[model samples]
Structure formats: structure tokens, C-alpha cells
Target: MGQQYLFWFAQVHDDFRIPELQSVAEIHGFDLHIPQDLDASRPFCILELDHEEHARLLARRCILIRSVCEFYARGSTYEELHERVRQQRPRWSCYIEDTSFKFIVTAYNHTIPQARQREVVESFSYMDFLGKIDMKSPEIIMTCFEEYPDKHGTTRPKDEGDGEFKEVFFGRLIEEGSARPLVKKFDVKKRLYYGNTSMEAEISLLMANQTLAAPGKLIYDPFIGTGSMAYTTAHFGALVFGSDIDGRQMRGKDKQPGIIRAASQYGVAHCIIDLCTFDVTRNPWRCGELFDAIITDPPYGVRAGAKRLGRKSRQDKEQPPTSPQNIAFRRPDDQPYIPPTKPYELSSLASDLVLLARYMLKPQGRLVFFLPTVTDEYEELDVQSMLCDGMEIVANSLQNFGSWGRRLITIRKATTEHFAPPSFEQLDNVAHIPAHKDFREKYFQGFKKSDVEQISELSDQG
Candidate 1:
């Protein structure tokens, strides 16, 4: 008689390419077998009876047994075992004499048909059989074949049906039963400003397209406002680190609690570090650590606090005091109110992005971030310049969430040997300049008339 065994695969993200279950089995010296014609995509596998001894060997080595057949030793034929039991007792009939032997026999036969083949030396009794057997002490119990159904929908019988059984591996069962449920109770999407419930599913698909970092590679996010980008990336098994200049935005009364909740829900390990409070116009990122990849969404002007309606006044003559012109503005009612800092000029945003690419990214590493179109005319030009500065644009696509139209840009840092040549469009041109002259003149004093003339001359020469 051969032993029987069961195999199963653990759930994982699509980006995790290794077949974890099969590898584990092979390591333990079990003959790996898939059900005949089983789809490779299916989540389970069935090793047949041919490798029974090998299965038992692995099971013992791997501590796979949930229960054991203590009363019935392995490799014992049914009739021979019964005869041996009869020889041990001289007056076994006395035990069955008072019990309903017929009923016991019927139930026992229904469960294990091998019982019927052996004649009872004394009259068979249900109470006697029940008293002799201990269900809880079994190291491995034999199950009827009626339970397992194949893909063709045919089920094997208890007796004549190969007695095919599935062993419930003790450790694996306990681990699965004790594991936390994947879906969280809260409406995760509702917690986000423009998030949808399908965002997780969509991100899972995008991560599948990229090569996953091995378990310890660091994934960084600079503009991690609510931690969504970090949360999604960490699901693929990378260690995530994130920072934001405005810690208040990440830790606001309403927003901070949500970040905590999301981190709890997703099982992402992270640390919130400050990216420094210097203004983007005056300072570049000073974070010393480099990352394998960076993915984030910077603030877009749509629905910004500066665009909110001001307080209504009873007297028409009451001009709202506008003396503090440089003060950042915010809507008090909104969670994590951001003071209105000077708006980002498109050229400055592009320049800051280029700087981030140079400093933060590892050679040949990737970056995926969202860039919104501030103005229609500059959309294509901004994208082109970013790509021309030694970054390879792998994917550029539209992301529509609520009323905002966002462009998702995926760029890979180029190695020195394969550095992308700077393009004509990337040169200082009028289209790359700020739209307001006064703001430009005050903030961009470093930019020279000669530089502007040089750009114009280059444009004409092109």
C-alpha cells in the first residue's frame, strides 16, 4: 500500500515570478507532480500516488502531517491487519455483545470499505469499535475518495476508488488559517482625494510590467503625500522609504490617521523622514541616500488651497486685507491645509525633476511619477526636455481621477556609457521660460539676456 500526499501554492503578487510552493517541495526531495493537463495558471497542484514513499519521506522531514493513523500501521493489508487484531484477543465478542454491532458495521463500512473484507471473529459492535478507536490521536487518517473531484467533475468512490486521500499538512494548514485576511474593512479609496477602489488592482498590473527588486532593494518616494505610491510599490516585496518636505501634509489631523490606517491595512513597512523645509526655488534635495527607484505624485495646481473661495463680507466696502502678499494661503476647512507657496514655474519643476534624477536615482534605475499639465502649450515640451536629460522615458500615459487629468511618466536613469544625448528642445528656449515676466525677472535674475539670445540663435539655427 502506498502513502498519499497533497501540495498547494501560496498566494502572491503577479510580479513575484518564482513558484514558491514548487521550489519548497523540490528542496525537501519530494517528487513534484502536477495534475494531468492542469493549467499552469491554476493555484493548486496534485502529486500522484506513484511518489508515495517519497511523499511520506518529505512529509516526515518537513513536519507536514496534520494527523496520523496510530491504530493502523503503514503498509498493512486490511485483512492481514484484522486477523492480527483477532489473534490478540480471545474473547472480543463480550465487548460487542451489549452494543448495536450492525449499525456500527454499516457506518464503518461507509467510511472505510476495507473494514467489510475482514470477518469479525466475534459479533461486530458499534460501541466496541467506537471505544477502541481514538479519533484525536491519529497521526494520519485515511479519507474516502468521494471528497476530491477532478476537473472532469468525476469523483472516485470510497472502496473501489483507489482510496485517494489528501493529507492536511499540519504546519501549512495552521499557517493559512492563522494568516490575516487580505481585504481591509474600510473604503480605502474613499479615504484618498481622487482614489478609486480599483487603484490597487491597476497598480498591481503596472508593477507586473517592471522587474521586481529582490527582497531588500530600497524603493524611495520623495513626494509621498498620503503614502499611496509607497504602499503600492511595497506590495511587490521591495523595502520602501519615503519623505515629504511638508510633513504636516503627511501628518495632518485628518490625513495622518489615514496614512497610519493604510500602512496597517497593507502590511507595508516604512519610515517617515523629513526632506528638509527649504523652498524648491532656493534649494535642491539634500537627502544623502540613493534609491533603486522612485515613484511619487507632486502637487498639481488643480483643487489647490489657493484656488478656494474667500470669506463673504456683509459690507461691500470691506476689502479683504491683502497686505501679507507673500504669506502662503490655505482653506481652513480642508484637511492638511497647505500654505500657498509661490506656484511652481514649469521650467523650475522640470529642472528640479532633472536634479532629483541626477542625485536620488541609482544608475540604470527607474522612476515613475505623475506630472499634470499646468498649461496646454507646455505639456509636450516639458515631457521632451525631461526625457532629453539622460533619462529614458519608458511609458507616458494619461491618468484621469476625478476632474484632474494627470500624465504618468516612467523614466529610467541612463548609465554614463548610454547617456541620452541632450536635444535642441532641452536648451533654454522661450517656451521653457515662465509665462509672467516680472516674476521671472525677480526670481530668475541668474538667467541672462545673452543666454536668451543664445537660445534664440540656436532655435533659428535648428
Candidate 2:
């Protein structure tokens, strides 16, 4: 049997925990066996890995995990736990002799007071080691975790020592997560250049993992506003190329492009090949299967609206010169000709993005992006409708924001076959009117205007 490793994950982004773990293992080419009854809502889960190196790889790459530990013993009560630890003494006894160690007591739902924390540590005195105590540095680090019931949606206050722990786990620390620091390192607030819709660091790192970004791989971001995913993907050693419909978003009043500026800020500027301005539907690429992965966060008409290259109205369409003398004069060099654009529908954009991924991504390559939807109207089948013939969904994790939520979708190109572009009828047959239709409209009107007004009135009264 493989060695069991307990993964203590950060409580944030619970839905992304398993997917990130699986992706990290897959990217490193390792076998990770997750338990059949794995509960992601809880902060801890034990996974079976072939070696300690595999656990270290997870710690080094996975952002959701806070730390990984070698599973020692676990039980619902301290008595049962002590018995298990005694039975497993042969496995851990080597560290008990001449080894400087420190113990950490932590809880999931409820905080353990300092007095109780000392008592809990004293309870483990049965394993009498003659080593000195080291809080800053230790040859061996032991951890005890108390898991209480999930209190996510509960509004009631938690009192001191009020809840009984559902379970307690004991383990020897393996490694603290190395990737968690990248979140603060690449924080958008600290970035030199960022836009209103720039993706936060944590989610961007999660998307990068979903893409399996690694050294020598090439990735593309179609809706690269301020180049959020580009930096994270590049930080993983992947070469990144990004594009946006509006050049202004990329240029950002600086002589150098904002994306490039931010990439330089993160010390990954060399990995960013170039940032271009073009409508994704009318991209400049003339080839297919050119990138290892395509990762992005497509605009859903919230903070910024999605746009495509086209005439907004018939009046803007090209008109033939009625006479030879009707020729238009060339404008001054200071003014450049700008193409007219039209609103790109969210539903159509989603289907087209899948088609683009099928065409651009290498076989077995991944396409990771976020799609926003109304919480009430969303369905599993809605996501299924946008997939192409050679592509399949790998993971779909949601980040809910009450009335509306954005789902981070990861799709993989499954086949090596070079299929023709999908026809309009084919797209029409599988298309579903997404819950995000008229999202910007409903985002304001759908939330019940009276409720908002009432809240505002209450705020004013206070």
C-alpha cells in the first residue's frame, strides 16, 4: 500500500481543492489516490501517494494546500488516537530519539484557546523524546488537528470550547505549501499595472494549474485584459501570448504595454512573447494546434463588455463609391483608421471559444477559463452544450457571488484527429440559451430593485 499523506488545505475555494490536487499530480506525472469518501468541505483529507517526493511535489505546486503531513494516526477521541499512535510507534519511533521537535494544535471550525492548546500538547507526553523543544526550527514537526462541524452559513457566534470535535488527526509534517506564497507575491493590488477586471492572484494560479502549465509549454490567453493569467502561467515556466480587443486596455497610458509592464513586475516578462489587439472571432492566427494550452477569463459584459470585429449597424457597412470622384481622402498620419466593433453575445462567445480551443490547442492540451451565469438558471447541460467533437470537460468549479456566479471551466482536447470547423447548424443544434444571457441587464434589474432601495434607505436612516 502507498504511504498515506494528509493534506491540510486552506478553507478558501473549497470546490477547487480536488481539481487542483489532481492537476498538480497530473502535471508532475505522479499517481495520487484520493479516498472514495473524500470530503472537500473539511480542511483535511488523506491521500495515498507512492513516495514522499510525490507529496513534496504537491506541496510545491498546489496553491490550495497549506501543508501536507505524513499520516500517523486519527480517531474521534484522544483515547482511540493514543491507542493508534502506540500501535504505530515502530513507524515514528526513530524521530522520538535525539530529535528536536515541535507540536502544533489547530482546529477547523472552532478556535482552541491557549490553555486548552497547552493541555492538548501535554496529552502527547506519552511519547517521551529526550530532544529539546524548537518552535522556529525542528528536526521533526508534529501536528494535531481538531475538526468540528462546518459552520460556513451559520450566523450564530461560536463560544469558547462550545463544540465537540467530529474527529482529531495526528501527523508528522512533510512540507508547507510553496505555491501559497505566490498568491501574495503576485497580488493584483501590488501589481504595477492592473485593470478593473484583472483576475485575483489565487484564482489565476488555480486556472494556471488547471492548464497544466509547465516549463517549455506554450499558452495563450484570448481575453488577456491586464494579463492576469499570463503572469501566473509564465511563472510556472510556460511561454505566454495574450490578446485583447481593445488596445487601450493593454497600453494603459504607458509607452510599454500594461501586460508587459505587469509581466516585468513579476519577473516573467521574458515568458510573455507578445500582447496583440484583435477580436478573438477574427483572430490573426492562420494555423491550428499551435499552443500547448489556452487559458483565459472571457469578458461577460460586467466590468467590461465583450466585443467582436464588425459593423455595429448597417450604416457602418462598406459602401461602393457611387462615382470615381467619390473616393475618400486619406486621413493624416496622426490619426489611424479604427475598425468598428459590435457586442459579442456571451452565449455565442462561449461556443466560439470552445471551437477556438479545439482548433488552437494541441491534442491532450487544456483550455481553462471562467464563465459567469445566473445562479438560478444554471444547469449542468448548459456547459455540455458548448463542447466540440474532439474536446471534453475536465473540471468545472464555481465561485458563487450570491445572485450570479462565475464557473472556472477546464476542458481538454481529447483527440488527435484534425476535424473541420463546426458548421452554423451544428453549433445551433447543441446551443442552449445560457443563464448569462443579458447578464449585465439582469445583474442590475434581476436582483429586485426594491430590496436594494430598501437597504439603501435603511443605511441612510442609520
Candidate 3:
């Protein structure tokens, strides 16, 4: 058995909290003994780890955590909590004689008044610490949390005095979560170069964490528009390579590409190995097992649809001219040639991405990306159908947006065995149909019904 620790998490991104914690733990080579009955709606949970260092590591890497603490006592009432503290003094009393400490009072679904907080702190005064209270910088910190009933989606003002709590937890604080600040530091709105499709800072940082981005790792982003994921991964010391079907998204009409310029903005230019332009389905790389991980946000045709090099129809596929005079000629000053492309379906792209990962990723490397889908239509099979041989899904966290949602999927290369790349014919018929097959059309359909309903009401009034 390991030491039990209390994990206090940020209130936002509830769905991603567990997956991010699991990924960080796996990256550091440890298993977290999480309680099976954990509640996602609560901001805090108790987990068991081998050492205090493991808890600190999680606080450092997990963006969703607010703090990590050494668990001491938890009870439904203050009297019960105090009694438990007296009973558990043997585990925590050693530091009371020499350490300077301060108590922090926090509530999940409500705010605690400062006056009431002081009284709550005084309630635990029987521990009889001999050291002076130091508020500026304490050698030790004590945290007390009051778990309130979930008041999510309601806007009522908090009541005066301490409201009823479902439970109270007391602990010695270990470390505050360090990764949350990176969200503000990498805010996309503050970046030098970003397009409308650029990923938000927090989500990109989460994606980077899922890839286990760290020093000396080589990460590639096939749909690297404006290099959103590239910057964060590089910030974490990973070497990044980015490519896109359209060059303009990265270059943005400048001699110095926007990807490199933004990389410089974050002082991580050296970590960006290079940026190239090519259709992912027709990529130029001839090597295999080169990348440590492939992380990307494939276009979902919302703001911009994904594209590939091909004609819209078979009849539009033209062959080179055979006759000498039949061939078209260009002058020295003629406009540059532009390749034709067609809409790349989300389902087929996902299947091909898995195939590409099988060929390009190092053994045990990861593939982390986002897939948007109609919420009601999504199923476990939709993701399972996309997995190729030697690959397995590790995490699938959803970011819901009412009628639709995007899943931040983390798939791992499970085995070192190499599998033959599927032929185009085989690729076209891979497994069950994904929920995101016609997501763009379905997403719009959700809005159309509401508009139709509004018109019907107007007609009835008329």
C-alpha cells in the first residue's frame, strides 16, 4: 500500500482531469491507485501514490490540478474532522514543533468568508504548534476544503456564513500545480501569429501533455496550422516538425514563416526543427519509425475543412499530354503551378492517420489528436474501428459543446512488431463507420431545426 494523497483540481475542464492525470502518471512511470467510486463533479479526490515525489510530479505536469496535499483526516462534520485529526496526530505531528505554517480554507461550489475561515482555522488550534505563523512564506502549509453540493450552471449569489458542507478534508499541502500558469503564458490571443483555426493555449498545452512532450523527443504535426501545437510541444523541450497541405497557413504571406516566427516569440525557435508543406496522404517522408510521437488537430471542416491532393471526380483526373504540341508551355514569367485538392473525409483521414502512425512512430510512441463528432451519435465502436494492428487507445477525453463535441484521443503504439501498410483499397473499407463521418453536415442540421422552430412560431403569431 502507498501513502494516500488528496488531489485538488481546477474547476474547469472536468472531463479532461482524469485522463490528464493518468497520462502524466504514465509518463513518469508510476501507477496511481485511484478510487473506483471517484466523482468527476467534485474538485477534489483522494489517490494513493508510492511517494510524495509522485504527487509533486503530478502537480507539476497536470494542468487540471490546483494543488496536491498529504491527506490526514476527512469527515462530514467539523467535530468529526477534529476528532480524526487527534487520532491521526502520529502521522503528522512531527513537524509541529519546528515548522512555520499557514492554513488555507477553500470551498468547491461556494466561497468561504474570511472571518469564518479564521474561525475554522482556530478550530484546529489544539494541535498546539510551537512555531510562529508565517503568512509570507511558510515552511509548511495546511489546507482545508469544504465540499459543497454541486451548484454548476446556476448563477445565484453565495449566502453569508458557512453553508452546509457534504464533507471537510484537512491535509498538509505538498505543492501547487505549476502547469496552469502556462495556459496564460501561451494564450493564443497574445501570440504574434495566429489564424482563426489556431488552437487555444490551454487545450494545446493539454494536448502537448498527452504526447508526453519533453526534452529530446521528436514530435510531428501533420495538420500544423499556424503551429499551435508545435509551439507548446517545443516549449516543453520537444523537437517539433510541422507540415500542412497548404503552405499559406504557415507562411502567412511572409518570407519568415508564421510557425517559426511564433516559435521565436516563445523563445523556442531552436526546438522547431523545420516546417514543410505537403498533403499528409501524399507526404514526402520515406523513412519509418522516426517520430517519437505524432500530435495534431486535424481540421473538422468547421472553420476550415481538411483537404488532400486529388481531383473532385475521377473524370477531373487529368493525365500528362503525350503529343509534343499537345503539351501546354509556360513562359519564364508564368504563374506558379498550383496542385488541385478535394475535401478529405474525416473518417478516411482518421484511418489513414493511424496507418501513417504505424509506419512513422517509434515503438511505444503515441498519437494524440482531436476528433469532432455529433454527440448523440458517438460510440465506443467509432474509435475502436479506427485502430490498426499494434496500436491501442490509451485515453479518450471529450470536450463537449452542446450538440457536438471533440475528443482528445491518445493512442499508443502497443507493440514493436511492424505491420504492412494497408493498400488504398483496403484503407477505403476499414471497419465500422465513425460517428464523425458527416459531422459538418450533422452539426449544421442541429442548428437548422432550431431556426425552423423559430420560423414556425413566427408564422403562428402572424
Candidate 4:
């Protein structure tokens, strides 16, 4: 039989755990089995992969997963779990032979005591091993986990809390999850440049995983801020490119210290192809080239309002005194023409982003991006709604923040059909992005009239 492995997911952001698994597996060439009814919110689940090496590869890139192991036993109760562990003693002994090992217990969704932990370890004393115990650095880590669900909506375990066990699992450590190291390496705290909407490193890496990023692949982000997606994509060896309507996000014409600093810090400075000052509504890419992935967190008009290139509807009737600070540099016979920015509707921005992906992505290449929504009013967006002639939905993962959260949606170009841009009406009917159309107004409506000044600062939050 093919080997069975267990992946331990952090209780936080459980929604992303499985989708990240599917993505990492697809990118690495492993046809992993995805359980249809699996509760990804739980601490652990068994993955039926073709080989042990496949499990190792998954652990290397997975951010939501805490660790991966050779699954030994799983059960609904302590009695059943111990019985299964006892049955595996013959094979277990062989695995432990000539190997220094350590035992660990993890009680998920609940707190465990040291005395109780020792009692559990003593229960497994019947097994035999030839090597000495090594706690600091063991070749093998045999683990037992007890999981419990909260008594109610509150995950906070009270001082007198004693939650009932929901499940039990046992496994041998294959590898620890890569999320920790990757997070430390690209943390936004250390980034030289960032926006109020500047992305966190863990989420950026998770998005990259969902995009199925890999070395030598081409990825682009249209709303690149502080190069979150850019550097994270480069970290995975992808050639990254990005554009934004806001020149301020780039800082200056020749200097993008934040972007350059981050890329340099991660040693992926060479992967950044270029950063263009272009509007998504009016895509500037004319080359026949296509990208392997298009990943972004588009402006929701919540923090930073969406904008586009345009001109005033009416010309100024008067010319005022021009100081050196406001003087226009031009030839004597030439008239300087300046372009102003107009409000770009959020619904239109969403439509444009998807259309851009459809036109520029290679067949089988993935388009991953986030869409905002209310927690209680979230209408799950299906890939069917955004389907073009050859596009298919690959994955959808959601994360909530108070009453608001964003969904990470990925769709793939399944065939070689040329992109045929959909009409505004046609695209609007596909998903619930209408909420974004008035996002800024509705978002600010929550505050009092006195808080208008704070809106500027609020828009700057990451």
C-alpha cells in the first residue's frame, strides 16, 4: 500500500489548510487524495500520498501546516487509540531500532498538564528500542495528540476548563512545517516599504502556495504594494512583475527603496522583473508573453480607494499665477496636458482583474487573488460564476476578520482558447462583488461624523 501521512495544521486559519495542501501537491507533482468531507478546522488529517518523499516535499512549502508525519494510528477515544498503537508494536519496534527518539504530546484546542502527559507516555513503555533517548535532537519523534473542540463559540479555555476529547492521533515525525521559517524570513515588520494594506508574510506565502508558484515560473501582481506578492513569489524562484496606479506606492520614478530593500533582504532581488505605473482598467501589457500565475490582493476601496487614469470632464476657465513649486516645464510652443485620476468602481476593478488574468495567463496557469466580504453575509463565490471559455476553479479559501474577511480564490486556464472579455453585466452576475462598489462609503458609514479625519489613517492600515 502507498504510505499514509498525517499533516498537523495550526488551529489558526484552518480554512486555508486544505487548499494550501492541494496547491503544494499539484505544484510538486503529487496526486494527493483530498477527503471530500474532511474537517480542515481540526488539528490533523491523514493524507494518502504516493510516497514518503511526497510528504517531505509538502512539508517543505506548506505554511498552514505545522508538521507532517508517518501516520501510525488515529481514533475517537483513548482506549481505541492505545489499542491501535499496541497492535503496531511489531512494526513500530523496527522503526525505532538503532534510532535515538523523543516522545511528545500535543493537546489541541485544550491545555494539557505535565503529570497527565507523563501518564500517557508511560502507557507506551511496552514498545522496545535499541538506541538512547535524545530530547534535544532526536532522529525520530514519536508523538501523541489529543484534540478537543471548544465548549462554545469562545475558544478561550477558562481557568476551570476541562474540555472533552474530540479525537486522538499518533504518528512519527517526518518533517516540521516550513511556515515558521518562511514567515521569519519575509516578515513585513522588517520590510523597508509597506502600505496600510501591506500584506503579512504568512498570508503572502499562503497565497503563493495557492497560486502554485515554483522556480522559473512567471507571476504578476497588478496591485503590488511594498512588493508583498513580488518578493514572496521570488522566494519560491518565480520571476515576478507588478504594476500599480499609485506612483506613491513605488515612492519615485527611479527609486523604490521598499521594494528593492525587501527583494534584497530575501536574496531574490534578481527575480523582480519590473514595476510599472499602470492602471488595471487600462492594461498596458501588449507583449505576446503569458504568465504562469497572476496573484494579487486588489484594492477594495476600503483602505485605499481605487483610482484610474483619466482627465477632467471640464477644462479650467482661468490660469492663475504659477510659482516655481507649481510651475509646469514645457517648450514655448507646446501646451502641457496633464491627466487626472477618477474613481474606479470596485465592481469594474474586479471585472478588469479577472479579464486581465484570462487574457495573460498561460493554459493551465493559475490566477489567485483575494475578494472582500462580510463575515455573516458572505456569499461563497464559485469559479463557475467567473468561468470563461477555458477557465476552471482550482481552489477557494476564506479568512475572517471581525465582521469582514477576504476569500482567496484561484482559477486555472484549462485550455488554449483565447480570452474573450466578458461584459460588465455578464461579469457582475457571476459573483457578489457589488458590495465592493460602495465599499468605501459603507465602510466609513460605520463611524461617526466626527471621525472623518481618522478615515485617512484607517485607509493606511495593512
The candidate 1 region of ten consecutive residues with least summed lDDT is 170-179
> CA lDDT of each candidate?
0.42, 0.86, 0.87, 0.75
Worst 10 residues of 4 by lDDT: 422-431
Please give the TM-score that candidate 4 achieves against the real structure. Answer: 0.85
Better model by lDDT, 2 or 4?
A: 2
Best by TM-score: 3
Please give the lDDT score at residue 109 for candidate 3. Answer: 79
Q: Which parts of model 1 have CA positions greater than 4 angstroms off?
A: 1-187, 190-214, 254-258, 270-289, 305-340, 374-382, 400-404, 417-462
* RMSD (Å) of each candidate, 1 decimal: 17.5, 4.9, 4.1, 5.8
Query: Residue pairs in steric clash, candidate 4?
Result: 196-460, 196-461, 196-462
List the candidate numbers ranked by lDDT, top first.
3, 2, 4, 1
Compared with the true structure, what per-residue lDDT tens digits does model 3 show for residues 407-445? 999999988987655433335455577789867656655
Q: Rank the candidates by TM-score, best first.
A: 3, 2, 4, 1
Q: What is the lDDT of residue 148 in candidate 3?
A: 90
Q: Against the true structure, candidate 1 has what lDDT?
A: 0.42
At residue 310, give the lDDT of candidate 3.
65
